[model samples]
Target: MQIYKVGGAVRDRLLGKPVTDIDWVVVGATTEEMLAKGFRPVGADFPVFLHPKSGEEYALARTERKNGRGYGGFIFHASPDVTLEEDLIRRDLTINAMAEDDQQNLTDPYHGQRDLEARLLRHVSPAFAEDPLRVLRVARFAARYAELGFTVAPETLELMRHLSESGELEALTAERSWKEIARALMEDQPQVFIEVLRECGALKVLMPEVDALFGVPQPEAHHPEIDTGVHTLSVLEQAALHKQPLTVRWACLLHDLGKGLTPEEEWPRHIAHEHKGLKLIKAVNERFKAPKDCQELALLVGKYHTHGHRALELKASTLLELLQSFDVYRRPQRFEEFIAACEMDARGRKGLEQRSYPQADYLRGAATAARSVAVQPLLEKGFKGPELGEAIKGERLKALKAYKEAASV
Candidate 1:
């Protein structure tokens, strides 16, 4: 049996990128043979094994046929007769279809190297449209290589659009969809992921809440971009620029979704969009089954991002209430993430990216000062139970009040 290093390992190496994982395709190998050679069986759907020494994944060279609809409706054939070229041709992207032999000989039956040099993302074959998941995969690759000046081939994008309209995307499970989306959000140019999805019409199918924001108008004075959709993408970009975590980035993406629901008579003004967006955010979370931390943060940012923007002007009681709402003393990290999401929103507007967001520091300082109030001191004064809780709240309010007064000077 001949083993060839395939997929991402070879692709990244050709592009002078740091290869983090290596996947191997065993040609002319059977399941029985792999087991005899000490490879441990691990694949549930097909013939995949883990190397006894390196523990890296080694999938038998296999070919797939589209048996029905959606991603799971596929039948894979793996045998000693399956050719390396056949396995390579079945891959999604041309760049990911090339393989390398142990002797360092490269095989490029699909010209993946040529596409790589041209910085184009082209499909491997006509079967590319068979799997609906490829639409998300292609968008994710675009996001990964966007900074490298890579663009999806026009013909491939047409196939993606076809897939979006084919009603096949509806069959995709929430877990699978969320897996791709969460990965895309962590990419360097996650905005490209959203843009590509919107271009191929998948955004409306998978994330209509976000899609609805495109034509929605916002106050031009505050948002030079003036398009809610454009601003949302900008916020995602800003979140990446700040190197924020996934929760922060997800919150940034969903922060302005309520504007899409604003009445046409309201035009550029969305007076209560923050509160209005909560339902949409909940819908997205329910649809994707997003992680609890991600959903919780998104909900908070959706309900109170405007409050963050107007933090300095808020009454001391309002500010204290906001702190209590987040439970800042117990979970300071979530508050920090909320502040980062808000900062991204504030800077996302056109011509306002570099502007200072003093609200972040002001709110952070408030949290710190409020957290510094000692519960032990209140208890030391014979305050107990309900009285102890009340005394602690009073002291925290006083500290926040003092902080606000000091900041005003």
Candidate 2:
């Protein structure tokens, strides 16, 4: 029973990153051999076994081929002949190609250690084009390792371009694509991924709606950049600088999605971009299979685009009523995320030659105050079950409509 530690765990350990999960490659061991060795068989489609004591995964050496279309449309081959070297060759990047034996001996056939040291993301094999998903992986790794000063190899970039243009990505499942994108967003420099995807033409196929933002001009009163994509990327950069939640980051990325469609030919042009964005966000959410919360947050950001923070100067009761108008618990954290996105959106326009948005502090303060009272105090009021329901939906909203009525009564 031969066991070798493989993949991310070893790479992350070498890189000083926390290794959360461990995967092992078991050579000279069959599924039956694994079972006999006290490992429990778990994987249904693939030959993966779990160690009874350690709970680490030990997978049989396997190879794959594109049998049908997308990422999942592959036929896996697991046999004794499949070597560790073969598995490493199928990897998308050289940095991820290193494997360590059970004794912690490095077995890097592709010079992955050299590439890792050089901060380069080079493909291990020319077979990269066979799987369209590798393009997204390259972009994701680029984003994740950008802080490491890594750059994608030129030939790998060419391969990505060819795969993206070949329409092979369309065959990939939305879930897989989005999962990678979500990971990319969590990376240090998501804009690098966006830029790389755009270069390879994959961004067009996956996010045509977002791609439409390219070259679309905003009002001269606002952004100096000609396109909504530029504005959106700027907003993303601002959010990254703040290191806010993922939902907020996502909102910033999509806040100006509607701007591409807004008319800007007239002087005071680009009217009602918020409403237009709300409609478009629905389609965008569906395209990416975004969760309900993400959809609602996008919609709220779009709806409140022109609302501003003017309402916050009112009395506490008045502010409570204003916040109550929206069902908070129905989509908890939606408003907070919206506020974050809007803050980034505003800050993105701060230094433009003729910016339109107001300073962000006013909006941020109002949202922060509203959140503090609306959620915490309401919870403190001993409001539970039907009572909490009334607070979130009825009283909270009623407080806004008739502040005097609710307070005086």
Candidate 3:
């Protein structure tokens, strides 16, 4: 059996990128042979094993036939007779289809290297349309390598548009879709992911709430971009530029969804969009079965991002209520994440990216000062039960009031 390094390991190496993981394809190898040689079986869908010593995955060279619809409707064939070229042709992108042998000999039956040099993301074959997941995968690769000047080939994008209209995307499970989306959000140019999806119409199918924002108008004075959809993408870009975590990024993506639901008569003024966006955010979270922390943070940002933007102007009682709503004393990290999301939103507008967001520091300081109020002191003064809680709230409010008073000067 001949083992060759394949897929992303070879692709990234060719691009002079840091390869994080290595995957191998074992040609002319059988499952029985792999077991006899001490490789541990790990693949559930096909013949895949782990090296006994290295623990890296070793999948047998295989080919697939589209048996029905969607990504899962496929029958995979793996045998000693399967050629490396056959396995490579079945891959999604040409850039990912090349392989390398142990002797450092490179195989490029599909011109992956040529496409790589051209900085184009072309499909391996016309059969690329068979799997709906490739649409998301292509968009993700675009996001990951966009800094390197890579773009999806026009023909491949046409195929993606066809797949989006094919009703096959509906076959994707929430878990699978969320997996790709979450990964894309963590990429360096996550806004491109959304843009690609929109270009191919997948955004309407997969994330209509976000899709609806595209033509929606925003006040040009506040959002120089004027388009709600453009503003949302800008926010995502800002979150990525800030190197914010996934929770913060996710919040930025969903923060303005409610603006899309505003009445046409309202035009640019979405007076209560913050409160209106809560259900949309919850629906998205429930649909994706997103992690609790991500969903919670998205909800918080959706419901109260405006409050954060208006931090300095809010009444001391309102500011204290907001802090209590976030349970800032117990969940300070989440509060910090909320502030970061709000900052991304404030800066997301056109021509406002570099503008200062003093609201973030002001709110953070308020949270800190409120948390500094000593509950022990109130309890030590013989305050009990409801009285203790009331006394602590009073002291925390006084602290926030003092902080606000000091900031005003």
Error of 1 at 83 (Å): 0.2
* Prediction 2 global C-alpha lDDT: 0.73
Lowest summed-lDDT stretch of 10 residues in model 2? Answer: 353-362
| lDDT (10s digit) by residue, model 2, range 1-409 | 5678887888888889899998888876677778888999886888998889999888998888867776777788888878888877877787788889768899999998888888888898887888899999999888888888888888889999999888899988778887888888777778788878888889888887678787777665666664677777777777777787777777767776666776546423567677777777888788778777666677777666455433434554545543554444344456556666766777676375234444244434444443443656778888888778667655444434454344336
Which residue runs does candidate 2 get wrong by more than 4 Å? 224-226, 263-268, 309-325, 329-332, 350-409
lDDT of each: 0.95, 0.73, 0.94
Question: How high is each candidate's TM-score?
Answer: 0.99, 0.82, 0.98
lDDT of 3 at 323: 93
Q: Per-residue lDDT of 282-350 in model 3, one digit per residue for the tens?
A: 999999989999999999999999899989999999998999989998999999999999999999999
After superposing candidate 1 on the true structure, give the runs of residues whose Cα lies further than 4 Å from its correct spot: none
Q: Pick by lDDT: which candidate is best? A: 1
In what order do the candidates fall by lDDT, top score first?
A: 1, 3, 2
lDDT of 1 by residue, 1-409 (tens): 9999999999999999999999999999999999999999996889999999999999999999989888899999999999999999999999999999988799999999999999999999999999999999999999999999999999999999999999999999999999999999999999999999999999999999999999898989889999999999999999999999999999999998899999999898998899999999999999999999999999999999989999999988999999999999999999999999999999999999999999999999999999999887777789998988888899999999999999999
TM-score of 1: 0.99
